[model samples]
Target chain A: MAVATQDTAIRTGRFARALIYLVLLLFVLFYMLPLYVMLVNSVKPLSEITGGGMMALPQVWTLEPWAKAWSTAQIGVQPTGLRPYFWNSISMVVPAVAISTVLGALNGYVLTKWRFRGDTILFGLMLFACFIPFQIVLIPMAAVLGFLGLSGSTAGLVLVHVVYGVGFSTLYFRNYYAVFPTELVRAAQIDGAGFFQIFWRILVPSSGPIAVVCIIWQFTNIWNDFLFGASFASGDGAPMTVALNNLVQSSTGVKEYNVHFAGAILAALPTLLVYIVAGRYFVRGLMAGSVKG
Target chain B: MAANATPDFRTRLQTWLPKLVLSPSLAMVLVFVYGFIGFTVYVSFTNSRILPFVGPDGQPTHDLIGFTNYAKLFSLSHWEISLTNMAIFAGLYIVICTLIGLILAILLDQKIRGEGFLRPLYLYPMALSFIVTGTAWKWFLDPGIGLENIMQTWGWESFSFDWIKNRDFAIYTIVLAAVWQTSGFVMAMFLAGLRGIDNEILKAAQMDGASNWNLYRRIIIPQLRPAFLSAFVILAHLAIKTFDLVIAMTGGGPGRATELPATFMYSYTFSRNQMGIGASSAVIMLMTIAAIMIPYLYAELREKK
Candidate 1:
């Protein structure tokens, strides 16, 4: 009777494990479904998608949609496609990410290593900047950008992102450097190393991990940003997201679902690439940003 | 005398260098974030319309009208709809995301095979821009060419999933997409929390002959409070700031069914020529977010101290 009871217990455990795996597999499918649809539909001719074959793999795969989305698709009365806007996004994101990460690293260094009076209050002030809804500052920002002669320009968008992004970058580095041994900094100081020298030589070499975290975080954010891009820049200078939105939402002509999917993929590709390459750092940045650790 | 003077000057420079390095960011934050916030708050109480009334001296002409925009905004039916939609959306989005996230986390925490493969697949959505996710989901949920069509084609002829086009249910579709996007990140958070739990405690509980259900209910879930709180705060804030997804999916359509505060603020300030009213709405959104964030930040920061 004891032997039989053990056998039944083992059987039930196996059943539970199978159930767990099945549920997990279902969720995986659920998550991948949108992506699968986007990819499958983007390549098929417009006929296949409209013919109720969205779920079925295409009988004839073509890259015409991609080619059209890249160079000749209509985006708000302009046939320039998403290519220029893709470059616009690159220019904007590169400068914004670089500037913000450097500033954040410096700010984090000072806040942690060069602690002073009311520093916590100052850090708190910067940290809170990260969370405020951008709507509160829209009107003023528009006016300011106009005054600075930057309205409707990529540079204007870059400045706006940098200003906002510094808060997050600072948080990333401060948390990272907080646990960094201060003794090294002190020793460098004792050995007659100057401020910039100590930072460059002693601290920066070991800051690779946190720097990757900050850069990836900022890169994804500035690249994916639509609000600032839509609000601050327009015309030929609009970023990839804004341009993509225009392409997809433009009401004139037939609803080219294929081109829309291709355009959406083009917009998503850069950040998605960053994420795929550096996902571990990306997750660390997400946790660090959200959980305040 | 020269040596003494040089050393003193260097000391002073070193003392000031860090502040100098920090000053540019501080100045930018001050002028851009705080100063701009102050400017918006002032505008909310003014008679400023499409163009802010700038004086001849190149300053904002503050024709101070106290709370008039606030009154007008609160009285508008459109604003009321937006607020009501926000309440429903944020509530449902938060609750559903948390539940789904917790379940996924718990399931993944069981020593499963292919853990690495499943985790990244779950989280890839977070990497995509909301606009991208919005585009994908917009089509996937469309009735004519999407799920309903596919279902009907697959011989489920009675299937109907038109929530994206329905007036009352359009907002729920936003909630669905949002939960899809961020729930994975929440699961990661909870998994991190679970992994941090001491295994010896689990061993001790098992030694007491506790059932698996009781073990999770009484011990494991209780220790996940921090993860739960973080997920709630993050989701609440994300729900409030939801604009891109709504725009991409519905455009606040079916006659303004999904007009979130973010979208409302955009249309009023940028489109409807109601700067004062728009600023008022924005202030309220900020206040709502602050109510959630301030205490959380205070606790998190103070605990660190």
Candidate 2:
């Protein structure tokens, strides 16, 4: 009798586990539903989409929408398409990411290793910059850009991204270097190495993981930014997010849903790829960055 | 004697190099960050219209008109609606996200099958931009040709999911999209918190014949306070800065029903040429964010000390 009861308990336990998994699987589906819909609808021709079969797999698959989205779709009056904007985003992001990462590394090294009076206070001030709403600075930033004669230019956008981006980059590196061994710095210094020398040789070489985190974080943010891009850039200089917004919201002739989806996917492709490739580091970055949140 | 002089000079320079490298960042922050904030606050109090003008003498000028912009902002119906919408959006977004995130984290912590594939699948939306999410969900929620139409064709004849087109329901669609994009991130945060809990406590409770529900409710959930707080702070900030999502999804549309403060600020300052009022609204938003952030930062820094 005891054996039978034990068997029943085991059976119920297995059933309970299955139930938990089923719920989880349902959530996974819920999360993935939008992406599935995007891919399915994107590949289908307009005829099938309008046929009231949104979820059905495409019987006649074509790349025409993708092609048109890349080259022929009008973002505004310009039919040159998202191709230029894609490159525009790349140009802005690359320089912004590179310069900000290097500066953040230097700041982190100095703040952590070379402690001076009020250094923590200074670090705190920089950290505070990260959380301020971008709206507060929009009008003045525009004026600043205008004063510098960089209004409506990609370089202006780059400058905006780099300046705003420094806080986050510094936060990442500071936390990373705080727990890092100071013994190495002391040893290097005792060997007659100077500040930059110790940083470049000892600290920087060990910054592989945090560097990935910083670069990916900055790349995703700068690439995906719409507010700065929209405000600071205009025709021919707009980044992909702004361009995608215009393309999707543009009410011209027939709304090519396929083209819109393709354009959005293309615009999002890089960051999505980064997440897929290095998601572990991305999650680590978030944890480290927002641990005190 | 010459060698000693060289060493002394090198020591002084080395001490200053860290400061030298740090000074530029400090100066940029003072001007670009704090200075711009000061500029915005100053602009809010002035009667600047259309553009901030430069006088013929090449000095920028604005007429000082104190509290006029603030008064005007309170009287505007759109501003009232924007505040209402933010309350509704922020309230719902935070509650729903936290609940769903905690639940998902609990489920995932069960060490279910296919954890690896499931984790990233849930998190990939966070990788995509709000623009992409807004675009994708806009299509999904469109009544005529999206989910509603799809449901009708699936033989649910009375099925109607037209929230995207309904003004009253339109804001909810934004909530839907925002929740979808963010819940997984919250899950990751909670999951990290869950993993950090001491396993011996759980084992001890299990040995004492405590039920799973009791273990979670009595012990585990209480310990997730930090995670809960972090999630609230992050979500609240994201809720306030909800510009790109609303713009991409609805364009604050159906006759300004979904107009958020961020969108309002953009349109007023740049489009409508109401720079002073926009600046005022921007200042209000900064204050709101600062209210939450200042205390949070103080707690964090103090905890460290």
Model 1, position B69: C-alpha lDDT score: 95
DockQ of all candidates, in order? 0.46, 0.45
Q: What share of the true interface contacts does candidate 2 keep?
A: 0.65
The interface root-mean-square deviation of each model, in the order shown, is 6.8, 6.9
Q: Write the per-residue lDDT of candidate 2 for residues A145-186, one digit (tens) a residue.
A: 888999989889988988898988988898889889999899
lDDT of 1 by residue, A73-104 (tens): 99856798899999999999999999999999
* TM-score of every candidate relative to the true structure: 0.97, 0.96
Docking class for model 1 is acceptable
What would the per-residue lDDT of candidate 1 be over residues B38-146, giving only the tens digit for each residue? 9899899997886646877899766789999999999999999999999999999899888988999888877777787788889988889988989999998999999
Each candidate: RMSD: 4.4, 4.4
| CA lDDT, candidate 2, residue A44 | 79
Error of 2 at A81 (Å): 1.5
